[model samples]
Target: MKNVKKPIAEELDLFEKKFAENVRSRNPMLDRIMRFIIRRKGKQMRPMFVFLAAKISGTVTEATYRASSLIELLHTATLVHDDVVDDANLRRNFFSINALWKNKVAVLVGDYLLSKGLLLSLDNDDFRILKIVSTAVKEMSEGELLQMEKTRKLDIKEEVYFEIIRSKTASLLASACAAGAWSATGDEEKTRLFHSFGEKIGISFQIKDDLFDYGHDNIGKPTGIDIKEKKMTLPLIYTLQQADDSTKRRIIYIVKNHNKDKQKVNEVIELVKQSGGIAYAREKMLAYQQEAMALLHQFPESEARTAMEELVQYVTERRY
Candidate 1:
């Protein structure tokens, strides 16, 4: 953590200006949702990865910026669609697109981002970029479907859960790195390494976020939002696996009941603690973090390498 690279706040301003240019030609309605979400524009980690990766390869160029923006737009689209599916109201402490614009608009917003991503990919006529982006979209959607299929189902298995994370969350991260690598160097081997690295970082990212679900401290969003929504994330899944038959029964009952009662929440919290779910997920997260860093080592050393490693460390240690 000592080696953490301070984020350039100005980079986001660049992203916003570029994004405004990218979306200005679109219809007014699509433009509105795009602008609405972009205004908050949290940490641009995905695009940062694209930019940093390109920079490391000594290929920082227009393609890097365009690819980075495309990744951000694609990411925002996913968030808009996810809000509609999850019925979320609050995100980044603002009303979600679905909450403000309603469900239909949210869906269209996601579609426009997808279309915009495609158009951006064509800027270099790199079919390889298209393939990477399309595959990630498919994997992400399939992950969502899988998650929905198992929602509130107490018998969810670990293998199935890993598959869901890999598809839904990891895939886009992988695409972000892979597309960045392709957009710059077109080296499939190095691209594959970065792709794997991003996926590992992504899975670790989700595991940490899921661990925050039961966090008492202000890790990020409300600790029990997933629990309130009847979602069973990593800690809970690990708890279910390790808890004794009786504790297991109680866990299933509380989750199946979709309990928001203070006592029920505490019960799940205690079970997660006793079952070592938090520790286990932390271990898994660290393992993935190691894997991600190892992947970056293949490229020798550079400023981009430092930033990339710093990004992984940031993801591992972030409170939110």
Candidate 2:
């Protein structure tokens, strides 16, 4: 991440200042919450994508900063709402908004952030970038609902898994790149290309996350949490696909009925490892990474382009 941020160091510093100003509120309570969110901010990868994509397409401008802030605002809002829905206590190792402020306040905070994002774009007449991100928010909602629907049934096929991730995880990243490119260059063609590139990278990112569920990584989440939640990931799907009928039945029964049982969840994880599910997922992840790199290569080589390439590699290589 250090290497990826090197080229955009100055831009990122300026963005942070501007983004801080953008999210400020006159209400003391809201202002305090906003400060808390900023202090506990994650890697800022989405804003990084926005700036890097802008630099690759054209020079970074004021619009690029707005694009980054808008994306972050929307992303943060969704995360706040997500914690309420998941009943999660933490985010990025910090107490979640819901955990700290209760669901009612957290939900209101999310709505506040979302409205701020919309007003920021609409007030500036950033119609093009707004359209791109709004579409992603819609897709994300659909993807999440689709995953929940599939989880209840535990019948997620390989294609359905891809669709869910593409919509849920990939759409926002895709829009970040697209919004950045459009903000900088106003070139529809380049914006579309970057959007596709981001989607491929996002898909690979999620696959790597799924693989973590079967590993002993200190990624802050427990092994087989996905299984415990009855979420069917690519590895588990592929593992079940290759199993004998009896084996399939046994695994499905465990996942559907015994998901909360530690011994049963471990058994399912072991089955995934023994059945080469990890290897299969890793292969697919690399394939998507290659595709994203290919699209990225279409742009002329530069410091920003190199940083973007390294960022792509970092997505699959990161420890957590």
Candidate 3:
């Protein structure tokens, strides 16, 4: 992340300022929550994508700052909402908004942040950015609902799994890149290209994240948490496809019936490992990473492009 931040330090600093200002409110509780979020924020990867994509397309502008803020605002809202939905008590090692403030207040804060994002676009007349982000939001909702529906049956087809991931994980990234390009040049074709670039890397990014569920990397959550939650990740999906009937039934039984039993969860993890699910997922993740790099190669060599490539590598290579 430090290396990725090097090239865009000045612009990123400005973006941070703008993001802070954009979220400021007079309400004391909301202000405290916003400050807490700022303090515990994860790597500002989405804003980095916005700036890097903007630099690749053209010069950065006020619009670029707003674009980055918009992404962060909406992303933060989702995280807040997700913590409520997951009944999670911690985020980035800090007490989650819901845990500290309770679900009712947390839910309202999330809604307020979402509304801020929408009004930001409207006030600026950034219709293109609005449209792109709105579509992403819609897709994300659909993806979450689809995943919830499939979780009960444990029957996520590969295609459906891909669709779910692309929507839930990739859509915001796609919009970020497209909004960045539009902010820079308003070139429709270039915006579309960057959007596609973001989508490829976003899919790769999500697959890499999915792979983490199979490993014991101390990544906030414990290993096999996904199984406990009955969340069907790509590796599990791929493994089940090649599994024998007996093997499949056993794995499903553990997931559906014994998820709370840690011993059973460990058994399921070993079965997935022996079945080569992790290897298959890694191959697919790398393929998408390479595909995204191919898109970056379409642009001429520049510091922004170089930084973007580094970001892509970081996405795959990150252990947490």
Candidate 4:
């Protein structure tokens, strides 16, 4: 990440200050929550993607800063709401907003962040960027609902799984790249290209995350959390596809009924491992990484381009 941020360090610094200011509130309670969020912020990967995409396309303008902020705001809003939906108590190893402040406050905070993002774009007349991000948000919501529906039935196929991740996870990253390119170059073609690149990267990113679920190492999140939630990931999906009739039925029954049992979840993980699902998912992730690199190479050689390549590698190679 240090290598990835080298080309856009100053821009990122300024973005942090602006982003902090953008989320400030007059209400004391809201302000406190905002401060808490800012303090425990993640790697700011989305903002880095925005600035790098902008720099590779053209220059990082003031509009680019706003684009990054808008992306972050939308990302944060979704995370807050996701915790409520998932009943998750922890985020990035810290108590989640819903856990600390309760679901009602967390929901309102998510709404506030969403409204602030919309106002930031509308007030500045950033219609193009706004449209790109709004489309992502809509797709994300759809993707999430589709995943929930599929989870109950345990009927997700490879195509449906791709659709779910593309909408739920890839859409936001795609918008970050599109919004940044449009803000910097105002070129529809370049924006489209970056959006495609970001989508591939986002898919690879989610695949890497799914792989972590089968890992035994002490990583960020507990292994098999996805299995426990009955969320069909690529590895588990592939494993089921390759299983014999009785084996497939048994696995599906375990996932649908005994998901909360640690032993059952571990059994599913072992099945994924033995069936070469991990290796298959890894191959697909690398294919997407290569495709993303090919799209990024279209921008020509520059520090920004190199940094973007490093960012792609980081996404696939990160431990957590």
Q: Which order, best to worst by lDDT?
A: 2, 4, 3, 1
TM-score of candidate 4 relative to the true fold: 0.97
Best by lDDT: 2
Candidate 4 segments exceeding 4 Å error: 216-222
Error of 4 at 74 (Å): 1.0
Error of 4 at 220 (Å): 9.9
Better of 2 and 3 by TM-score: 2
Ranked by TM-score, the better of candidates 1 and 3 is 3
- Give the poorly placed runs of model 2, Cα more than 4 Å off: 216-222
Error in Å for residue 169 of model 3: 0.6
RMSD of 4: 1.6
Error of 4 at 165 (Å): 0.3
Deviating ranges (above 4 Å) for candidate 3: 216-222
After best superposition, candidate 3 residue 143: deviation in angstroms?
Answer: 0.4
**Per-residue alpha-carbon lDDT of candidate 3 for residues 207-302, written as tens digits (9 for 90 to 100):** 888888887334543489799999999889988999999999999999999999999998988888888888899999999999989988898999
Go through the candidates in order and give each one's C-alpha lDDT: 0.79, 0.94, 0.90, 0.94
Candidate 2 lDDT tens digits, 1-320: 89999999999999999889989999998999999999999999999999999999998999999999999999999999999999999999999999998999999999999999999999999999999999999999999999999998888999999999999999999999999999999999999999999999999999999989987345554478899989899999999999999999999999989999999999999999899998999999999999999999999999999999999989998887
